[model samples]
Target chain A: MALSFKPIKPLLHTGTNASSRWFSYIGLGIGVLLLLCSVQMFINIQQLLKEGSIRKDGFDFVSITKNITNETMGQPEKNLFHADEIDAVKKQPFIAGVSPLLANDFRVQLSAGNVLPFSTDMFLEALDNDFIDTLPPNFTWKEGDQHIPIILSSDFFEIYNIFAPGQGLPQLSKETAMGIPVQISCYGSNNTVTFSGRIVAFSDRVNSVLVPKNFLQWANKAFGNKERQDASRLFLKLKDVNDPQLVRYLDAQHYVINRDKTLLGRNKIVLQGIFSGLGIFGLLVVILALMLFSFYLQLVIARSRQNLELLLTLGYSPQWLGKNVSKQFVPVYIFIVLAALLCTQIMQWAFHHFVMFDRPELSSLVNWMVVLLAAALVLMAVVTNARLVKKLLHGLG
Target chain B: MKLEIKNLLPTYFEEERKSTSEIWGKERSFSNGDLVNIVAPSGTGKTSLVHFLYKMRESYTGSISYDGKPLKQFSREAIAALRKDQVSIILQDMRLFEAQTILENLEIKRQLSPYHPQERIIEMARQLGVDHRLNALAQNCSYGEQQRAVIIRALLQPFDVLLMDEPFSHLDNANAKKATALILEEAARRKALVIFAELEKADHFPATHLYHL
Candidate 1:
């Protein structure tokens, strides 16, 4: 006797006033989105800061200098490097390559005809070709080329702008400065050599004005006094910048790091603390939303006590009824989570477009890590609400 | 299937009343297809007896077993399964969902057991004289119509036992006769035992066994 009957529709008693708690759903959505954004922002910022601080390729190089100490107090000659100390630093396991700064013991003067008041004596330090971030294909120079390529510190532009306005001098942009050629005259003990110096690039890591190693070697042979060029500083390439052993060893050896290459450890710590605090606050909001949802469910069950008991008498298991009732809210959960994910993606786009505007390395779409985080949050909400519904049904029993 | 009851005493009963009562100590057993009419006056715990047997009220001191398993040992799911597949009850208040139509009330039970076809449910309603009102909401129906609808609902399930708590309290003699004939016909077809609690058995009522609680 197969019954020709329709499926059992959910009774009025099993339904809920979920629409009345629309604010809770919106609250949870915002909370979850904020949580995801904070975590993603923290990840992106950390990656940006880490990439800015340390490089693992050939670019991961830092310049190290021995501090001016009491032992070398007015002895300018002793301020130069000793070969044994350089060899000891090179022998360390972390150092990939160590090159000494080739400082020509000569006087160099720069003149820009009527653009400068007088010829200014400038200090020149040259490094290896591998240290240049973007070495142009034609960066090399010959002995008679009379044209020297120079790299200036990025900070030099900022300092120039600060003083030039007060000094009534025109400020030079990077492009403007690149085209300007100035006269350079070098003086040693017996001879004087003249060349034209052209600005090539600005350096964020290598702080000093840089020149070609070949030009320095040639100039040293022709005009330098010392037979062996003693370096005052050394460039070191390490595998990892955040390695604790390297920092400890540098501190022990009384070495000074380049001022521009400071890592963002304390800044990252403060940022993580703030973002984690925001994450905790968002979690609290989600928890409060869940509590309100549970209360709403409880009220529905309470008001329908008699109808539920009647259902129980009709051979309906409370678990089955509870599941049916609990499943009614699954769509709400999906809608809120999808809404939150959509908003999070929008926020991520805004973040990459505006906040991380200039940093191409930090700009990215949503990471897989954030998707997992959102999935975890949805699972937490569903499982928690299901358990609450089951507990309430159990209480009815 | 058989139900056995021995030395049952409900905690809701007063201590002095328990001392003066004999029904609390009496033992009884009912087999399949046995029609037992429990005759008791008002405040005699007839509804309590039905509630206890249905496993709704647990504050009792006794052993009630279905087939050799004690009722106290059944888990909630097991109890619900027994209620779903083995027994049907027409509660005293005719617990048809007031917010639903008469056909919807019957469908609630009919969906649980697919063997009861819609035609048969409608046929039962026709025999009970409530077929014309089946589309109306239960709350809007007259008391007798609602009572017949509950009777039809209880019969829609395939039960080895049917429990009725004063099922015909609101029905007139003619309607009670028609409702009883339909219940007995369905019970006979399924070989289901019938238990009904009433204030008194009518002269025209045909009962196989009568017990004064």
Candidate 2:
């Protein structure tokens, strides 16, 4: 005949604290639900953050400069980044690549000869070719080349258009501007030189007059002051623009960065903190519920001590008693966990459908990690209950 | 199976009691099919000896070994196994789950190690004159009825040795006679050893060996 625990059930007398037992079960269910929801929300937030951001060149290319403060007034050296500072920025784990924006060490004047009659003393900057958004094939120069190619910032053109009509000049389009020939006058300490410059392209990234690196190097060497100059700005390519460590590092060094890039990083830190707090709170509740259940177990076992001892004396092994006692709670634990998982799935579905408006970035189902955590929780409950029961039974022995 | 006892004396017993005891402070052996009777007055540690032999207590001086394995050396699991399949006991108090019915009490022992069919419980209960009280809660039954039920419950499991501590103390002459007959028949069926510890020798039991404690 198959052995049955029906007779042994009444011998244990676990039916005393019905209210406390139900309270523990309810607490366990709520704890599991909170933990699973926290994990699922964390996954959802990560997915949404990853898919929602826009990238111009498949990566964030941001320019950073030292913050100008009153303490460093009239000190140009403090405003510039030396080679060591550049190397340090390049060595950061979040930085993929770094290139300094080399500024013209010479004075320059530009004028469109007859098309717009515009002349101004302007600063020119150059960096690595990879950092430029638009690089035409003709935007290059060699030794002793007089025809210079220039890329002007789109913001500069917009500002020029705003003031063009008021200044009694023609409102030039980008195509018309690209065809205009301009004169570039360079002044050195002793001599002056002139080159014909043409606008080859417009850049939306760099907010300064951009020239080819080779042209800038040649011009600065031949017609510029003979003094080494540190870079005032650096263009950085980053693996993740929202990396909090990058923001922290830049802030620690008193460097100014585009706040729009690290805004998501700040929000992510707060979101992660909230979710982690929730997860920890859920874990504490789980532990407290288990402890309460353990106390209930102790009460039951204590009350049934004599009967259990008699049973043991009658040849029932402690292992058998423990297994039987713990087995009675297995189904309850599984039910609680599965119910919590179901609740989490519904919440995720609702979030994906109602809160997120059916976005493709987030799934309607809870993450598989939540399921794994639920399984682990069930195992933990079973193992804990069995161990406590065995220990108590062993004490009786 | 063989039970060996050497220089066995309860640690709580006075030194004067050991000199007159036959089972304590002496080397004794009981083999299979030996129906032994130990007679002792009240406060003589009769129940303690039964407990020691069953490995329920360890506060004793010498050693008791079952099949050359010392009883004290038996782990909880091993002792449980011995109780389930090798040794059985009937306590003087006739300990039972007070809330459980007499039939349920017997069913627990029978399910642990079933030596007979499920119907044998009812049949044995009937033979012991407690079949009518099988469905009643053990706490509600008379002491004599509970004692008879305890005998039936102890016989439900298979055993090579049986320990009884004043098992028939509550039963009257007729009921005690019935219980004794049923216990001896069950013991004989397995060719098992029976150690019946009591305050006085009952004339109904045909014991092959006798000792005084």
Candidate 3:
């Protein structure tokens, strides 16, 4: 027959200090709950912030330029990005890709011939096709093509519409503007060349009159003062908009980008700091609770020291006694942690339903990392309990 | 199995006192199935000799070895195994869990090694006149009854050597005779060695060898 512990149970006085044992249990449960909740909340906040700023194209693009401060205001070259400076920006870990906006070096004029009978001097810029928001099939040009296609900025169009009525010019809709053809004349040092220009698309991404990169390059080479010019602005594709390194790098270089996006990044840093502080506080609570449990274990063993010595004298190995004594508390540790996990799950579900209110970013259940941490905590408790019991029993020997 | 004791003397004994002893300051050997008796008055280190053989205390000057291996060299687990399988003892003080009943005390030892069947516990208790007191708490029972229970507890396990330290001090002549009859019967059944220690020789126990401590 197997030796039953029923006879041995009464020998060791583990039932002493009933209230203190329960207090430790409650403290452990609360500590576990606090830790898990902090982790879950951190994950939820990160998900919500990430979802709020994600672009429709699933890529973040920011336009950056050198600050035109009072010291460098009159020197145009200081505002332009040199080749080495562009390479340095491209080398940043946060930036996935970089594209420079090429500006026209020669003079250009846009004239509505018979439709509106309006003409204006304009600047043109071109960038890589990958950086362009809208790409129509005809937005391309070759060496022999006489027709030029252009993408106008929606903001520029809106500005023109707002002032057209007061200036005695007819306001045009997008469809009406696409139906009209205008003449673009490029003026060089000795001659002027004319081409028929058509509006192909409007972009909300870039605030410029954009043409094909190849056409701009050819035009600058043929009817320009110089071969190439430095880029005045750069469009950078970033991996994460909230990357603090990007903001710090930009600040160190005295560069400027969209303020609205950097403001969100700054808020993320502050929120992350707050959540990390809460997590550390929770961890401290867990450590304190574990120390309390260790004291309880020591009290029980110390009270029963004589009985344990007799048990060891009766050929009951210290190993056996240690294993059995530690086994008694395994259920308590597992139950406390599991109860905390259930509470975290309920809170997450309520948070998702009532607080977040179907915000598609967060889930209704706790994250898997929280569950793994709870498991790790249980293992830690069991191992610590066993080691302490073994040490105390070995002292008796 | 063999037990070898070489110049064993309790540390409390002075060096000049070693010359007046037989088992102390002299080499001795005990083998399997060799029944022996140790007779000595009180404070003569009879209990100390029992403890030294059990490896319970190390306050001694000389070495004691079991089966060619020294007792002090055994690990905790090895000592536990030795006590559980090869050696059993009835201490001068009956070390029973006082809060537990006599039956529980006997059952704990019986279950530890289980040399005898469960029915044998009650049968031996009846022979030693402790059957009626089996359910009584050890502290509540008389010393004579508790001593018989301790004997039953010691005989419940398998052993090649039995160390008894004044085992019948509380028992009357009639009760002691019954307890000795049961112990000798069990020892003879196993063909085991019995090392019985007492202040005076009991005519009932047939020891093959005798020693004066």
Instruction: Write out the backbone clash pairs for model 3.
Output: none
Better of 2 and 3 by DockQ: 2
- How high is the lDDT of residue B22 in model 1? 45
Give the Å error, residue B66, model 3: 3.3
* Candidate 1, A1-397: lDDT as tens digits: 4322223334534346767477678788878877888888778766776666656463467888777889977887677668888898889887787889877667888776565554568878888877766566666787788889888788876787678777776788989878878778899888887898888888876777778888888887778776656788888877656444566577788888754454454456567779889888888888888887787878777877766767777877777876776777777887887788787788888888887784777655777788898888888888887898788777775
- Predicted complexes: DockQ each: 0.29, 0.76, 0.56
Q: lDDT-based ranking, best first?
A: 2, 3, 1
lDDT score, residue A251, model 1? 72
Model 2 regions more than 4 Å off: A218-230, B14-17
lDDT of each: 0.78, 0.90, 0.88
Instruction: Point out the higher-scoring one by TM-score: 1 or 3.
Output: 3
| lDDT for residue B10 in candidate 3, whole number 0-100 | 94
Question: Residue A250 of candidate 3: its Cα lDDT?
Answer: 93
Please state how well chain A of candidate 1 matches the true chain A, as a TM-score.
Answer: 0.52
- Which ten residues in a row are the worst by lDDT in model 3 chain A? A49-58
Better of 2 and 3 by lDDT: 2
Against the native chain B, each candidate's TM-score is 0.94, 0.98, 0.98
